[model samples]
Target: MTVICEECGKVYHVDPDKLDRYKGKNVRVRCGECGHVTQMSRLMDAAEEPAYDFEKAAAPSMPSAAPPQREMPEEPAPRPDIAYRTAGTEGRAGWLGLRGKMVILFLVIPILLLAISGYLSQQLLRQMATDITDESTELVLQEGKEKLMQKARDVAKQCEVYLQNHPTLEREDFFYDPEFSMLAVQVVGESGYTCLIQQPEPERGQNWTIWAHPNPNIIGIDDIDMIRKALGPHFEDFFKVLGASEGMRESDGNYMWKDPDGKIREKYMAVAPINLEGLPFLLMSTAYIDEFTAKTEYLKEYANNKTAEIRNINVGVLLIVIIIIGLCILIYGYRLTRSIQYLTEAADRISVGDLEAEIDIKSKDEIGNLADAISRMQDSLRFSIERLRRRR
Candidate 1:
């Protein structure tokens, strides 16, 4: 049997008995000349190369009439130019050679850049959230501190007013004064502190009984004695400032002073001297450092908890956004890669002369446009080949 390629005009000889293999298949035999694979039916015709019966044709009447032997034709030498052209032609075949590579690169680079941009954006959001959380917590703590300071000043002011109004009363008599004594008691109750109102003996500078209210169980009169001992040397200075002040002196309020027993302590004290008829008296209100320290510690704990909650909420939001962005990137990449794969497969088919292979990519994107363009090129080439064949 003889086979001739419709595409490149290459011919092959095959046994007629082997024809069954080519039936009902889309198989094409490769043409060596153009490197195109033409359909088996298009390449072969069994009737063109009939089987010969050599024995019947060569029968006996030939003994004395045998023909003279003729010179054999030499085999043609290989043409280097043809070989080079065939190799060059084969190399130019295939879609992904250069154009396809460029298309793949165009799709892949953007996917990579989008992923990187998403990661960077997530980082920036996290940093901004952290900074805002820190600043907000600090502001809360500052406000709490300011409120505590203001409360301390109010208590000090009330104590000074009581003494100035009760003139001439002895330290003991001053405590017995119902109006002033009750006022002092009320101030201590509201201040959230264990306070003592003392009127020390004139010779002792002031001797008074201490009152305890709402103590945190660890602090007491003993703590007060320790505080008084710590403020011993600063006692004169405290009285001098107290006597000179009307509204609680700001400088006096923050100063560290010593009491009679010489121990170091911070005291918020306000004193007012009174002379009632012929007696002299001074009313003094004192608060220990631990009173304000406890409130500050509570504020610190509250601030810490609030900051943690904010951080947790911020992290949750960030993670959700990151997950959404990741999913988008994954979906985008999959679609882009799938379109390129389709183009690659179509190119491979077209390379082997299957110009009927078409890409079904329907996207309106650049890759889709490229696929459409290639399909058009294939149709145009097929049309040209058909026109050339009709002319022949």
Candidate 2:
């Protein structure tokens, strides 16, 4: 015979022959519906007698005709301990749900903050690069321009000495002498300037070329009027700035000036009160602004390109960091959400009456601890429900 436990709903098999051994005693039969062992009197009650036998006993006074058999009602199937188990499995509304929410919130908020931080960091880096580039460009240009000015000064000094040594030739002949022209020729050659020097009294000018080859190119002139016309009034200021004296004195060093058209020029003009042969003369060397400014343009371009490259690299690094952080957050959120989903489903099952449902989580972190606590609570509730059912 199969019997169900009253306390734990465990089924047990018993032999019918054990009924005699159990007679006259309070037999402890384990309930199939629960694990509890219920005590009952060994004697069978009259209620358990067959209906035919009871009818026979009741009709004894009459002639013993066979009594009609009445149909017996079917015994109802034993109800399982659904209520107890359901009550046991019901989850307590405590910090577990809140904890899961906190986990999800923590993951999401940090990701958002990281994105904002990365954007701001990139902006700051770009600004710093730009500032550094600007400073570098300024310094390079300043140094280059200074060096070019110094070279012009040296060239002017050499030309002044040459004019002092040759003092016997006539003003016209001195200006025209190929040997004396050498100093002016060398000045323009070394100074990186396209130069033309004019001697008004000789009615002539010399154009000096210097930028390649063994020696400087020189041209002599005899047209004084043409030279004067080309010199213009600007030459007067140029000569004044150079401090040219009317006698045998040295000319001034190179002086820079901006013309009305905004072009910068360096000029060194000297005059001999008397020429090498005691004749009057003038010598001038001028270089245009393009010579110095050309070098600075390259520096500016380099600074701009370097700044752009640095900014791009910083931006790329920022993007990579952001992407990595975002992906990590997404993964964390996915796991957290999945855990919460499991907890929710477990809670739902408990609400409807399945106390044996277990909450298992893969993580070893706080969420895992929460799941463990929930499982333990379910087990405790089951124990309590079983105790109450047994007492009743």
Candidate 3:
């Protein structure tokens, strides 16, 4: 017979045949684990009807008991249906009931945040790179423009030195003298050249003469209106500097032209008044803006490539980080759930009144504290049982 304690729900298996002294009477059995006493009736396994009818078998006049014969029932007796169940376990919700909720809150949410943060960082990188390049390009363009102006100043200084060496040279010598003429035709750089043009003398009915220039066809031409037209729409700016006092210089507005390749491009020019010993000369310097910006196109291309590469690398790294994070979450969640499983088993044991069962978990977390509480309860119950037995 299986007995379950009503006080602590402890289960005990006792053989009914061994309870010979308490046959058919109520007896108390103390549970070994919690010491709970339960009343149970001892039972003897006796058949309901005899296998043979004894009254019919015994005959008063039989000289000798003829060989005894036994009568059997037509059918076997029905077996009793007995089932054993632990007390207080019907309320258990089962394992894995709470782990699913924990997984969503602790694992899923953080992974989404990680991916979002990574994408945002990747997006901002391109803008950051653009800002850096823009700042550096501004400085380079300013330096290039400054260098052009300095070149103009150096040319003016060279002409001053040339005039000092030729003390007796007259004003007209600048046009025909080979040495002075070559100085004006020197190329500053590609798309840049030096030139000397004289001011218009309206009194003598003489027009502006290009005294020295890279273009031999225009050297002695007195075509004033035609020359201004060839200087393009922004020629007034050059005229402003030319008419200024000696040593004065100024920049003209940007000049637009189509090169031999037919691509529209821009350049800028500056003019300074040159008085070499009273010989009036206009020193004009011209250079294309394309020279300064030529490398900028390539730099812009490289920046684009760099941005693409960085984004790709960022995505790859994000994927790797996510994988690593997911693995860690799984490992930690498993361990946490395992601890919970221990608490569950210990609780089941206590519910069945098995107070002596060891809760071997030694952790200091919540589950361990719960086991300690159960141990305390077991001790209290055991002590109460001892006191009651002593009083009895």
Give all candidates' CA lDDT scores: 0.51, 0.51, 0.63
Top candidate on TM-score is: 3
What TM-score do all the candidates reach, one by one? 0.48, 0.49, 0.54
lDDT of 2 at 141: 44
Error of 3 at 206 (Å): 7.4
- Clash list (residue pairs), candidate 3: none
Give the best candidate by lDDT: 3
Write one digit per residue (lDDT tens) for candidate 3, span 247-312. 444544455644557565677666656656445566777778767766775676688799999888
Candidate order by decreasing lDDT: 3, 1, 2
Sort order, TM-score high to low = 3, 2, 1
lDDT of 3: 0.63
Off by over 4 Å in 2: 1-161, 187-191, 194-284, 293-296
Lowest lDDT block of 10, candidate 1: 77-86
Q: 260-374, model 2: which lDDT tens digit per residue?
A: 4766565443322223343333344344434544555665667667767866776687668657766665677677767866876776555433566677787888888878877
Could you give candidate 1's per-residue lDDT for residues 1-392 as a string of tens digits? 44444555444554545545444444455656665556544344435432223222323355657684343343332221111112234444475444444445654565566557656665665566556555655565454445544544554456556556654544444335666555544443233331333343357454343432333242223343544455666655555554454332232343465534745666455444332233333334445554545555565566556656665675676567656755665677677767776786677667556777767988998998999888998898789878966764
Alpha-carbon deviation at 196 in model 1, angstroms? 9.1
lDDT of 3 at 270: 61
